[model samples]
Target chain A: MKAFPAIAIASGKGGTGKTTVAIHLAALLAAQGRAVQYLDCDVEEPNGHLFLKPKMERSESVGIPVPVVDAAQCTSCGKCAEVCEFNAIAMLKKPLVFPELCHGCGACALVCPVGAIRETSRAIGVVETGRTGTIGFAQGRLNVGEPMAPPLIRAVKARRNPDAIALFDSPPGTSCPVVATVRDADLVVLVTEPTPFGLHDLALAVDTFRPMGKPMGVVVNRADDDRRVQDYCQAENLPVLAELPDDRRVAETYARGELVFDRLPEWRDRFDALWSRIEECL
Target chain B: MKVVITSSNKTLADPIDMHFGRAKFFILADTETGKAVVHDNAQNLHAAQGAGIQSAETVAKLGAEVVITGSVGPKAYKALQAAGIKIALLEAVCPGTEALRRFKDKELPVLDKPNSEGHWV
Candidate 1:
C-alpha cells in the first residue's frame, strides 16, 4: 500500500526539540496557505497541543479487544489459558482474566471450544481532534499507567486529515511507539542538539530508521559552538536541513506555551527556510 | 490449609526464590495433610508481563489458602486477595523449610499492600 505523505519530527533523546520543530513547521506551512494537519503521535506526553492550543471539536476513547470468558459455557477445557502467550488468562477453579496483561490478541477466543470466550473493547487511551486555525490538529493521550502507547498512536494516525499534509510530532527514543509513529512516514526530520549525548543518541536514531528505508534529514536545535553534531551528520551523508542557534528567548517562549514564530518574528525566517528545505527533501 | 512458598528448587532445603512471579518452583504445602508438592512455574517465570498475577493464579489453582513470598507487586497482591488467598511477606533467599516453618508458626507479616512497583515502566 502507498503510505501517506507524512513527516515525522523525531528526536533520540527527550527535550531535544522534536515538538519544537513540528509545531513551527505546521504553523509555517499553515500561514503559507498550505493544507496542514498537526498530528501528535507522542501519546505518552504530547506537548504540541500546548502550542497549537487546538479547540477540540471531537474526542473519543480508544480501546483494545480483551477476552471476556463465559464461565457457564466453559467446560474447564483450559484452551483459553493454554493458547494465551502473555499469560493473560488463567484457569483455576474458574477462569481468571487479567485485562491489563492482555495484549488483546484474541488467541484464547479462537481456541475456545464452545465459544465461551468473547472479546470486549477495553478503553486504553483517547484521541482528540480539532483545529487552531488553518492548521487541523490531532493528538493521542495514553491513559496514565497504561503499558502500551502504539495503539493510541495508531488511533491518532487513523484520525489524520487526509486532505492536509501530516506533520507527526513523535515521542522520543527509537522504541515501539516511535517505530509505530514513523514507520509509515514519507519523510522524517530528525531533530537533535550538539552535546555528546545528543550526537550519540542521534546516531542511535539514525541507525533505527535507516533500516526502514525512509529518507531522513537532521535539524539541529539549540545549536551552539559544538560542531560534533554537524560533523556527524556530514560523515553519515545526511542533510542538515536547518540549525536554530541557542537562544534564551526561545526557551522562555517555549516555557510560556507560545510559538517562537509568533513571539519572535526574527525566528520566523529560520522556520521558513526549514520548511523549504524539508519540501525539497520530501 | 495449604500455603504456597516461592522456591528456587523443588527441595525444601533449597533457598527461597526472592522473585515471586518468576520463581522456579512453587512449593505447595498442605499443613493439614503434612504433604507438599513442588510445581514447575517455568511458564510464569518467563511470562512477558503480569508474571505475578499469573503466579498468584497458579498457587490459587493449587488450592493454596496463603501465598508466602519475599515481596509482591500490586497486581499479584490484588489477584491473591481476590482469590481469597492471604499474602504473607518473608525475606527472600531463605530456606523454603524456614518459610514453611514461619507459615506454620504464623510468624510472617501479612502484606497490606504491594511491597514494590510493577516491573513495567
Candidate 2:
C-alpha cells in the first residue's frame, strides 16, 4: 500500500460521521499490521476518544498570548487600542484588555510605543495523548466559552507521528478550524449524507478545499438512504471511495461507545477495502 | 452637553435602536443647541465580538456626557461609566428625538448598573 502521511476526514455539516469513518479507518489500518495514528482535530467537541477508548497517558494545556498592560510605565496614548483589529483593547481612562476577544496576534504589543504592552499566556484548551490497542490517538478539547479553536487544533495536529499513517478527524463546517486541520493533509476524504442539507454543505466544503489544490474523495455515509449525494459526486467527477449501507447495528454500537468492528468483525474487511479504494485514488 | 442616542436611522425621527452596540447609527445630540449629527456604526454592527466595547469607545471618543439607549450591555456600561458618561435607560421604544426629550425631561431613569448581560449586542 502507498503511504499517505496524513489523511483528513472532513464534513461540511456536523454529525455526518466524520469521527466514525476516521476511527474505523485507523483501526482497520492498525489491524492490518500498519502503524496508524489518529488525531481528533475537532477541538470544540472532540468525541473520537469515546470509540477509540485510548487510555490517556498525558495531557497538556494550550494557551494563546494576550496583551498585558504596565500602568506604571504607561502613558494612555491609546496606541494599543488603535492597533487591536479585534477591538479586544480599549483606552478610555486606562488601557483595558478583553482577553476573550483577543486573537493573540500580538499586534497591540508590537505597536506599543512605550513598551507598556506585554503578552501573557491564557489557557484556551488541552491536548491529550494515549493509545487504543496498536493505534496511537490524540485529541484536543477546547475550553468552554472559548471563541477560538484553530490554535488548539493546530497544537493537536503538531503531535502527529510522521512515520505512522496519520488520520485527522476534522471539525465539521468549512470554518477556520476545519481549514487548519485539513490544510496540511496529504489527502482529504469528504463525508456526507444523501440529503439536501448534506449536498449543500458538501458543495461548500468542496469549494473550500478545491482552492487548496489537494486531492479529495467523497464518502457517502448511509449510502442507500439518499441518491442526491451520489448524483452530486458523479456530476463533480469525484470518486466515491466506499458506501457503507445504513445499518441499525452500526448506529447501536456507536451509541454504546463501541467500535462497529468490535461487534461486527465482518465490517473490518469492508473498512480495509475502503482503504484500498482510497489508495486507488492516490 | 453632548448626548449620544442609539438610533436605527440617521434622522432624529427614526426609532431608537434596541441594541446599543449593533445600532445602525449613533446620534450625537447637543442638548444646548438642540442639534444632532449621525455617526455610522456599520463596523461594529457586524463585528464578530466586542461590539459593545467598540461602541462604548466611539461614545467616549465623541466626548458625550450621556448615552440614551434601549439597552446597554455590561461591558459597554462599564466603559461608559469609566469615561464619566451617564447612562439613561429608555423604558419604551420611541424616536431618537423623543428619547432625547425624555432624557431632558428627567423622565428616563439613570442606569446605576448594566441592565443587560455581556454579548447582548
Candidate 3:
C-alpha cells in the first residue's frame, strides 16, 4: 500500500485554532479531488466533527493489557513489586494494584517466578470512523478515567488509509499525548493565535517538535491581537503559512459547528496555497 | 518470617523484598534478618487504567509475606487484605525503610489503617 502523506496540526494551547486549520485543510484537499483521511487524535475532547459534521460509521474499542492475579498458582513472593517502576503495586502488608497507574508493561508477569501474575486486556477508549463532507474521518475517545491518551491515538492512526492524505487534529500540548500523535508525521503545522498565551505555548511547541527534525510551519489564526506573532516568526525564520484575519463570520460559523472555508470559499484558496508550500517544503 | 520492600537495590536488600509490577515499586523486608528484596509493579507495562488489578497480581506473583509502601488507595487496600497480603502504610518513606530495618532487628510496626486515597503525590 502507498503510504499516505501524514500531516499533523498541533498547538501547545487548547484554543489556538489547530482544529479549525485541520478541518479547512481536509476540506480543501478533498475539494482538490484528493482522498483525505481526517483523524481527530484528541481523545479527551474531540470537537472536529462539530465543524465537519461527518456521518457516523463504525466504532471500535481500544484496549491494553492489565494484570490479573492467579491465587491458586501463587507463592506470594512479591517479585512483581520489585520490577515495577511506577510504584503501582502495594505489596507490604497486603498485595494490591491500582489500575489507574498501571502502564501495561508485562514485566510483572515476567518477573513473577511463581507465575501468579498474568496480563488481561482492558478497554481504555473507542475509535469512531465516518465521513465528514468529502473527508473520511476517524476519532478516538478515551474512556472516562483513563489517564493515558497516546494508545488510543496510535489506534486511530493505525486505521488510516495509506492512499489518502492523513491530516491529524492533535491534542493540545507538547505533552505525551501530543508527541504520540505527531511523531510519525511528514509535516507539522502549528496553529496559534496572536496573543501572549498563544505565543508562550507556541514556544514550547516549537521546542518539542524541533527535535524531531521534521519540516514545520506556523498558521496564525485570528491574527488581530498583535503583530508579535509575525515578528517572532520572522526572527525565528519560521514560515507563516497563512494569517487568518479576526473575522466575525468565521467566529459565527465556528459557533454554528461549520467550517469557515466551506462558507467563506476564499479560505479554501488560501489552504490550497498552504498545501502547495507544504509540498515544496517536504 | 518475611517482609517486603519496593527497592531493587540488592546491596540494601536486607529486610526488604523487591517486587516489581506495572504501576509502582515496593519493598518487602524481614525485621529480624534485615534481608530485603525489592518489588516493582511499575514494570508490568500494563496501561495505567488497570493499575489496581495489576498491583494485586504482582504481590501474589512475588509470594510476598508482608508488604510495605508509601501509600495505597481503598480499592487496592481492600483487595490486598482479601488476598491475605498484609499491608502497612508508613507515613514517611524513611519510617518504612527504618521499620524494615527494625523488622530485620526483630522489631516490626503493627499494620495500621490503610490510607484510602494513597500517598500524597
Candidate 4:
C-alpha cells in the first residue's frame, strides 16, 4: 500500500499557530477515514495534548549515551578530555564525566587508551504514545533543564506510523530540532502570521531550509488585510496554501483547549481545504 | 604561590576581563619570584558549552595554585576547588597588575562559592 505523505507543520517563530495547523490537519485527515498518526516533535514544551487530549497509555524514557569511566583501568592521561569537542569530559586528577554536557558522540570512549570508558544511558526525557479517538498520537517531553532537545525529538519521531499519514508538529525556529523533525518529511507546511515581523522570520525560515530543497508551502494564520506575506510568497514562488481568518471566536475556542474544526463548524471546511492544498503539494 | 588572573590582552596594563570563560588571555604569575607568563585563551571563547570547565583545566595545567578573577561559574569553581586551587573573587575593573597589587594587600574577597551561574558569556 502507498503510504500517505508525511507533512511537517513548522514556524520560524513561537506562537505562530504551527501546532494549531498540525492538529487541525491531523483531525481532517482522520475525518476522511484515512489512518493518521500525529507526532509532536516539540519535545521541549509540547502543547498539542491539550487540544487532542490523547490518553497516553504507553511511555518510554529517552536518553543519550554518556561515558562511564572505570577508575581501576584508567590513568590520568587526559586523552578523553582532548578528543571531546563539546567539553563534556575533563581531567580533574582523574578523567571526569559530566552527563549534562555530553552529546553522546562516543568520541571519549573511542579514544580511551585503556578502554576504561563505557557507554551508559543518561535519561533526558520521555516519549508517550496514545490515541485521540482514532488518531494515533505521540509526543516527547524533555525533562526540565535538559540542555538538548534534538535527541528526544528524534525519539518522538521514531514512533511515526508508516502505514498511516504522519503529521509532525515541529518546534519553533529553524534550528537543529526543527531540522530533525522535517528532515524526512515529504511536505513541510510553514504556518506563519501576516505582519512584517512574520515576513522577516518567514524569510529566515525560507533561507535556512530552502537549501534542503524540500517542497514547502505557507499557510497564513490569523490573516487579516495584510498583503505582505501573500506578496512575499508569490515573489519566492512559494504556494500560498491557505489563509486562516483572524477570528476572535477561534481564539476563544483555542483558549478553552478546543479544536477549531470541532467548535467552529465553518472552520471544518477551511481545514478540509487545507488538506486539499497539502495533497496538491504532495 | 602561583596566581592566574583573567586578562583582556597580553599586557599587564590592560583591564582584567570580567568574564572568566570568554576571557581573551590569562596571566600566570609567581608571587615569590615576581615572574609571569601570558597564555592565549581564544579556543574557549567560542566554545558552545563547558568553557568555564576547560578554562579551569588550563589554569590547573599551568600549575597555578590560586585564581583571581572578576567572577567564575559553578563548573569552573568546582573544577578549581577539586584541584586544590585557591580562588579570590574580585569585582574591580582594573588592570592585572592592580588586581595583583590588591591580592598582595589581601583586599579582594577569597571565594568559597561560585559567584555566577554556568554558561557565563
Number of residue pairs clashing in candidate 2, backbone atoms closer than 3 angstroms, sequence gap of 3 or more or interchain:
0
What's the best-to-worst order under lDDT? 2, 4, 1, 3
TM-score (chain A only) for the predictions, listed in order? 0.97, 0.96, 0.94, 0.98
Ranking by TM-score: 4, 2, 1, 3
Output the lDDT of residue A92, model 4: 78
Q: Alpha carbon lDDT of residue A250, candidate 3?
A: 88
Query: For model 1 chain A, where is the 10-residue window of minimal lDDT?
Result: A1-10
Summarize candidate 3's per-residue lDDT along A1-282 as a digit string, tens digits.
134689999998998788888988888888878899999999999988888888989999888787887768867677776677766565644445655566788888888887788887778999999997678999999987677688899999998988799999999999999999999999889999999999999989999999988678999988885999889889888998888888889888988888787689887777788787777666
What are the clashing pairs of model 2? Answer: none
Of candidates 3 and 2, the better by TM-score: 2
Top candidate, metric TM-score: 4
Q: The CA-based lDDT of model 3 is what?
A: 0.75
Per-residue error (Å), model 2, residue B72: 0.7
DockQ of each: 0.57, 0.72, 0.13, 0.76
Q: Is candidate 2 or candidate 3 better by lDDT?
A: 2
* Residue-wise C-alpha lDDT for candidate 3, range B1-121, written one tens digit per residue: 5655554343343333222233345555556676656664544445433354456556755676666654555555565666677765444444345656555554545455555553322
Q: In model 4, which regions exceed 4 Å deviation? A: B105-108
At residue A192, what lDDT does model 3 achieve?
A: 91
Better of 3 and 4 by DockQ: 4
Candidate 2 per-residue lDDT over residues A1-282, each given as its tens digit: 446478999999999899999999988888889999999999889999988889999899999999999999879999999888888888888878888888999999889889988899999999999999989999999999887899999899888887899999999999899999999988899998888898999999999999998789998888785688888888988888888888989999999988899899888888888898888876
Q: Residues A1-282, candidate 1: write the lDDT tens digits.
A: 223368999989899989989998889888989889999999989889999999999999999999998878989887787788887777666678888888888899989989998899999999999998999999999999888788889899998877889999999999999999998899989999999999999999999999999899999999989999999999999999999999999999999999997888989999999877887887
List model 1's recovered fraction of native interface contacts, to 2 decimals. 0.58
Model 2, residue A172: C-alpha shift (Å): 1.3
